[model samples]
Target: LTIKTKMLVYKACVLRRANLPSVTALLKQKRLRWLGHLSRLEDGRIPKDMLHGELSEGIRTIGRPKLRYKDTLKAFGIDPDQWETLAGDQNRWRQYLHQGIKVHDRNWLQRLQEKRVCGKQAAPESPNHDTYACNHGHGSCKSRIGLFSHMRHCKP
Candidate 1:
């Protein structure tokens, strides 16, 4: 089966179906999970410092800038600076992950709602309606918030 079909089967959206986690989000969760596993390891056994440490030895080429591991952590609402301490508490770390990862739709809804309230409308297919691009990229659609909502399920 195709990636889209698999994802649709795996995830369930609140208002609609097909809303799966983005690649970046899934990766962040995986890394956080690894951090949680690493926290349980004894010091010096698996290079604990290295796993929890930041390496800033080399210079990166200038441009749009690459996504760093630290960047993903920050994106997932984690503060890398004190991540060691935070991860020490397994329950706390798990709670944070659960809350952060589960709120993607809510976040998008908040963005779209705020836009509507401010009269900052998305380009609609009709004068009174909005068109969301297809998640499968087949074409555009006229489903009001589908434009904003399809973002989570859109395939690259």
Candidate 2:
């Protein structure tokens, strides 16, 4: 994708994250130079909804059988039953998945919901201690709250 397209995609990603409405108009404003190309493509293009529906139907009817999650977990030397016993919460199970634990091959949101219900998973963990600790152990951090406090103090 061109830089302009990449930026548009990034904006769309941000909107999706925030559950906001389409910003295609904003994209058009920034990328008016590419309007010619967009007009040409739109002349005979397949509708996105139709394309998505076709792909979805194709996937739903794919041939050949697949192993279930239980089987997959067993093949990986993990016991779903035993894991369930120790899970104690759905959130923990989701965290286990997020932590790269081999499990019953379930979808993430389902696992997250399960973990949430069981109180097993806590809030997402920090990937490292770097966010909290400085290289020199000065006790100053660059986290969101820290930056807010810094701005408050530094503002005239």
Superposition error at 94 for model 2 (Å): 1.5
**Model 2, global lDDT:** 0.42
Clashing pairs in 1: 132-147
The residue-by-residue lDDT of candidate 2 on 33-149, one tens digit each, is 232223234334654234223333445457867644444345334464664443444454444433332222223335546766788646687655455553444555558577456
Note the residue pairs that clash in candidate 2.
Answer: 89-118, 89-120, 90-114, 90-115, 91-115, 91-116, 91-121, 92-120, 92-121
* Model 1 quality (TM-score): 0.47
Q: Candidate 2: where are CA atoms >4 Å away?
A: 1-65, 74-77, 101-156
Candidate 1 ranges beyond 4 A from true positions: 1-20, 52-57, 108-156
Error of 2 at 118 (Å): 45
Minimal lDDT window, size 10, model 1: 8-17
**RMSD per prediction, one decimal?**
15.1, 22.8
